[model samples]
Target: MAGDGTVEWGEDRPVRLMDRLFGDAGGGGQRLSAPAAGAAVVALALFIAAELVPWMSVTQQQQGIGPDLPSQTSDVSLDTVGWGITAAYYLGLMMLLAVVGLVQVTRPHTRRALTAAGFGLSAAMLVLLVGAIRRAGEGGQYGPFDQGIEATVGPAPYLAIAGVLLVVAALVISGWRPVMATGHRRPAPADPDEDDDDEEPGPIDLTVTPA
Candidate 1:
C-alpha cells in the first residue's frame, strides 16, 4: 500500500521508471509519422545508390615540349568501395542505423537515445562526404615534368548530400524520437455497478410475514 491509500504492484516501479526515461509507457509518446517514415525510406535508398555509383573522377594528361612528342590522357573513376576501408566502415554503420530506424518507425513507441544516435551518425557521414569533395576539388600532379591532373566530383556525392538532408528532415518531422518496445500496461478503470452489487443486503426481513 502506498501513502496515498493506493496499492502498488511489483511491476509499477519499473513502469514508472520507463515512463520517466522515455515518455509515456502506455504508447502515448510521439512517433514517426507515416509521411516522415516514407521520406526516411527514400533517403536511405538514395544513400545506397550513392554508394554504388561513382563518387569521384580523376583525369591525367601528359605532354612534351617537342612537336613530335605524343600526348596521353587517362581517366579513372572511384566509388564508395574505392575510397578504402574507412569509407566502407562508415557506409556500413550508416546502413545499420538506417535498418534500425526503419524497424523503430514501424512501432508505436519511441526511444530518445536511438533517435539522437541516428542524427549524430548521419551528420558525421555528411561531414566526411563534404570533406572528401573539398579535397578532390584541389586536384593533384605527378611526375618530374609536373604532368597535369584534374579531379572532379561525381553525381554520387551530391546524391548522398540529398539523402543526408532528407534524413535530417525526417528526424525533425518525427521530433527526433525512435520507436521502442515497453512492458508497461495502464490499469483498467473500475466499474461502479460492480462495486454496488458487492455490498451486503441490509437486514433480511425475517418477520414471519402474514400466515
Candidate 2:
C-alpha cells in the first residue's frame, strides 16, 4: 500500500482516447466525439455521387457550324441509366450511414460493422460503376468502375440495404455498453469490505480449545 493508499500504473492515458472515448461526467467518463466515423459515411456518399454523376444524362441540342447546315437535338442515355439509379439510391441511403457512422465513431464495438458497411458500400459502388460502364453507349472516354446494370432495383432495395447496414452497425456499437434507454448502465455489484485489504480483522481469543 502506498502512502496515499492508491495503486499507480505508469501507463499514460491517451489524449485521443480521453477525448473520444472517455469524457468527464462529474461521477464517471464516457465517449465525447464521433467525427471520424461520420467522415467514413460521408466518403461513402461521395463515392456514390461520383458514380451517379458519371452515369446520369443531360439533354443537349447542338447548332450546326454553318447557318445552312441546320441544327440537331438528341436525347442521350448516360451509359448506365440503371446503374445511375442504383448510385443515386445509395446516395439517398446516406441518412442511415450517418447514424451508423455516429455509432461507430462514438463506440469501439462498431469497428467491425463499420468496416463491413464500408466494404459493402464500396463493393456496391463498384457494382454501380461497372453497370454504368456496360451501359456506356459512347465507349470513347470513360472512368473505370461500372459497366452499368440494364435493370435497376430502385430506391426500395437501397432503403432495405441502408436499414440492414444501420442495424448491423448499431449492434456492433452496442457492444460498448448496455443501455436500457433510461441512460443507465445496466448494473454491477459493489465492492464489499472483505474485498479491501484495509478492512479490519476481528480480535482473536487467547484461549485455545483442546482437541
Candidate 3:
C-alpha cells in the first residue's frame, strides 16, 4: 500500500498481463479490411441460422395388415432433434473462433492461431459427420421400426459448411493483404531523442526597449 492506500504493482505487471491475454502489445492495435470484417460477421450470422434448419430426415413405409387399407408412406424431417445435439457441439467451437476474431481481428498472430484452430475444428466435425452418415446408411434405427426408416442429412450441416467457408475466406483475405484501418495515431515510444517533442519551450520575450 502507498500513501494513497493503493497497492503498488511492478512497473510491467499489468502491461505484461494484457499482452498475454490479448497477444503482443506495443505500438498500436491491428484491424481487418472492410470486406474481411464484413465476411466474418456474415459467417457468424450463418452459423446461428444453421441451428434453426433441419439436420436429418427419415422416411417410413408400412403395409396393410388386412385387405382394406392400402400401404402408407410418410416423410419426416427431424429438425433440431436427430443431429441437433452434434451440431450444437460444432456450433460451440465456431462461436469460440468467431469471438476470438472479433476481439483480436487486427492482431495477425492471434488471427492466424485462431484460423488454424478453426480449421482443426472443421476437420474434426467433418469426420464425425461422415461417420454419422455412414452409420445411417448402414440401417441405423430411430425408433421401433427398422426396415423403413431411411436417414439422410438435411440442410443444417450444409449451412454450417457455408458459414465455415465464409470465415476461412475472410481470414485468408485479411492475412494475405494486411491493411491498417486506422491512421498514424500510435503512441510514441520512450526515448531520449523524443524528449524535446514533449517539452514545451518557454514563450519568447516579445517586448523590446527603445533603441
TM-scores for all predictions: 0.52, 0.34, 0.53
Taken over the whole model, the C-alpha lDDT of each candidate is 0.58, 0.44, 0.55
Model 3, position 57, has a per-residue lDDT of 63
Ranking by TM-score: 3, 1, 2
Could you give the C-alpha RMSD of every candidate to the true structure, in order shown?
12.5, 12.3, 12.6
Pick the winner on TM-score between candidates 2 and 3.
3
Model 1 poorest 10 in a row by lDDT: 138-147
| Residue-pair clashes per candidate | 3, 16, 2
lDDT of 2: 0.44
Candidate 3, residue 28: lDDT: 58
Encode model 1's per-residue lDDT on 25-67: one tens digit a residue.
3445534455466677888798788767666565555565765
lDDT of 3 by residue, 1-211 (tens): 2233444543443334323333323435543355666777787787777667555565555554765554443333322233654665567555646643753454766767777776666666555555544544443337434665566666666666677677667766655434333322334556776544333456678998899
Off by over 4 Å in 2: 1-38, 41-80, 95-106, 133-211
Q: Comparing 1 and 2 by lDDT, which wins?
A: 1
Flag regions of model 1 displaced more than 4 Å: 1-32, 63-96, 99-103, 106-110, 140-146, 175-211
